[model samples]
Target: MIPIRSAGPADVPVILSLVRELAAFEREPDAVTATEAMLADALFATPPAAEALIAERDGEVAGFALFFHNFSTWTGRRGLYLEDLYVTPAARGAGVGTALLRHLAGIAVDRGCARFEWSVLDWNADAIAFYRAMGAVGMEEWTVQRVDGAALTRLAGR
Candidate 1:
């Protein structure tokens, strides 16, 4: 059985490695720019920016889920926003990913979160199918918008 546990500062290196592996799996090997220090700061700070869960199978690290809390104005409540959910290729069929997600769902419920949400890349058919099978619906009418780097700086007049 896969066991899920909360990650601590000491797990930063493992988390970074998993993040890099996940980036490669998503066909963007060079996309992950986060370092172990960055992860430790964000996840273990006094007021942590996020939290993580590690999945293990028989003492082997199999996957991880990184998530944060988000506010929903309409609902007037907090929600859990999953930033990343990844299972190592070697452990894909061992139910590690599902266990991690289910663990997070329980956390959300216990914390009184209004919703549990995440984004899946459009081209990842396998991930899409997996989420759908778990009763997660795609918000087809909604579009995600972002502004970063130069655009964000310019917008802030910085």
Candidate 2:
């Protein structure tokens, strides 16, 4: 049985490890620039940038979901964007992933968020199916634009 609950500072190491694992799984391990210290400060410092939920099974940490509040421009209402979620291979099939998602949804509802959103890669069919089964609709018409690292530096320098 997996228990899901909010993460605290003590879980930062595990969370960062899981993030690296996920990046490696996506074949983009080199792209992960976040360090343990970065996660620690972002998750535990004053006015935190995000929050996390962890899944534990039989006293062992199994998975985690990290999220932060966002806003929809059109509706002008708050939203919850699940930045990362992962269940370790050893714990998959034990309801860890679903539990984390449902947990996040509860938070979203409690906070009156207009939406709970996350992006799964187009190749991740299993995840897409799971989300669809949970009544999540893909806004296929929308394209995601991002600026990171050098682009962010250049954009800000403009």
Candidate 3:
């Protein structure tokens, strides 16, 4: 059985390593610019921007899930947004990912969240199938928009 627990400041290094591993798995190894100190600050600050859950199997880290809360006007309730979920390469087929997701789902229900959601890359067929198997539907009609870096600064008239 895999045990799931909340991550703390002491887990910053391990969390960052898993984050890098996830980036590499997603074919974006250089995308993770966050450092350990950044993670510690973000996750262990007075009011954390996010929370993380770590899964351990046989006393070894197997996977992790990073998430935060959001508001759902439609439901008039808060929602849980999963930012990232990753299982070690060796633990992919061993149910680590599913376990992590299930754990988060429990948290969502416990907190009275209107929903739990996350986005998966369009090219990640395996993840798509897995999420579908777990009863998650794709929001095909919704398009995601982003503003970042210089574009964000310019838009803000900075």
Candidate 4:
């Protein structure tokens, strides 16, 4: 069984490295702006904004899953939202990704989450297939919208 555990302060550096690897794998090698300090604060701060799980294979770090909770007014309960899941190239086909996903699903069930959800890049057929194989269905009716950087500042009237 792949060992999955909660990430601690000591795992900050490795987690950041894995995040960079994920960014590169997503074809955005220069998109990562997260630093160890930023990650640590986000993961370990008072009422942490997010949480991370570390998966290990053969006593080595295999991948990580970073997630957070969101409220669903419709369901009147919280939902689990996976922000990122990355399994190293070497660990790709070794069930590491499956194990991490299964772990998160269990967490969602244990926490009474109304739903467990995440978005995958359309170009990543492999990931799409993987998620489909795990019983995930695409919400074709919904399209995600985002506003950040200068636009966010302007929207906030700052």
Candidate 5:
């Protein structure tokens, strides 16, 4: 059986390693630059920027879901954005993903979040179907935008 719980400092190394595995599965192995110390700072430091829930099976980290809360002024409500979710292939098909998602939903409900959202690559049909199966509606009307590197710096300094 998969055991789920909020991650603490002792789980940091496992979390970082699983993050690397997730990046590799996405075909972007070089993308994960988050160091263990950096994660400790951002995730466990005072005034935490985000929170994570981890899935473990037999004491091994099987998967994780990282998320943060967002505010919606127009709706006058808060939203929970699932930033990253990954279950090792060896751990898939064993209810890990479903458990993680359901756990997130419980938190959203407890916090009175208006919505729970996440983005999946268009090529990842399996995840899309899994999400749909879980009663998630496709947000086709929304377009995601981002700025990074120098662009982010310029925008922040403006």
Candidate 6:
């Protein structure tokens, strides 16, 4: 069985490393600006902004999934939003990813989540296929919108 557990303060460095790896895999190696301290605060602060699950293989850190809760007005319940899911190259196709996803789904169910959702890059065909195989359907009509950095500040008229 793939050993999966909740990440703790000690796991911040590994989590950041995995996040960098994921960024590189997504073709944005330089996009990551998060530091260990920032991650620790966001993840371990009173009322954590997010939660993470670490997947281990061969007694080593193999992958991680970071996520948080989002409210769903339509469902009148919270939904689990997966921020990132990454499996080490060596551990790919070894059921690690599947196990992590299953664990998250179980958490969503146990927490009475209205839905479990995440977004994938449009070019990531392999990941899209994998998610579909896992019974996830695409929300073709919905387009995600975001405003961040300077633009976010400008929007707030700050």
TM-score of 3: 0.98
Q: 57-140 in candidate 2: lDDT tens per residue?
A: 989999999999999998789999999999999998889988888889999999999999999899999989999988899999
How close is every model to the real structure, measured as TM-score?
A: 0.97, 0.95, 0.98, 0.98, 0.94, 0.99
Candidate 6: residue pairs that collide? none
Which residue pairs come into collision in candidate 2? none
How high a TM-score does candidate 1 get?
0.97
- List clash counts for every candidate, in order: 0, 0, 0, 0, 0, 0
Candidate number with greatest TM-score: 6
| Per-residue lDDT over 26-100 for candidate 5, one digit per residue giving the tens place of the 0 to 100 score | 899999989999988878988998898999877877899999999889779999999999998888898999999
| Residue 114's lDDT in candidate 6 | 93
After superposition, the stretches of candidate 2 with alpha carbons farther than 4 Å from their true spots are none
Clash count (model 4, backbone only): 0
Candidate 6's residue-wise lDDT over 26-136, tens digit each?
999999999999999999999999999999999999999999999999999999999999999999999999999999999999999999999999999999999999999
Q: What is the C-alpha lDDT of each candidate?
A: 0.93, 0.91, 0.94, 0.97, 0.91, 0.98
lDDT of 6: 0.98
Worst 10-residue lDDT window, candidate 3: 89-98
Candidate 3, residue 108: the lDDT equals 99
Cα deviation at 65, candidate 6, in Å, is 0.1
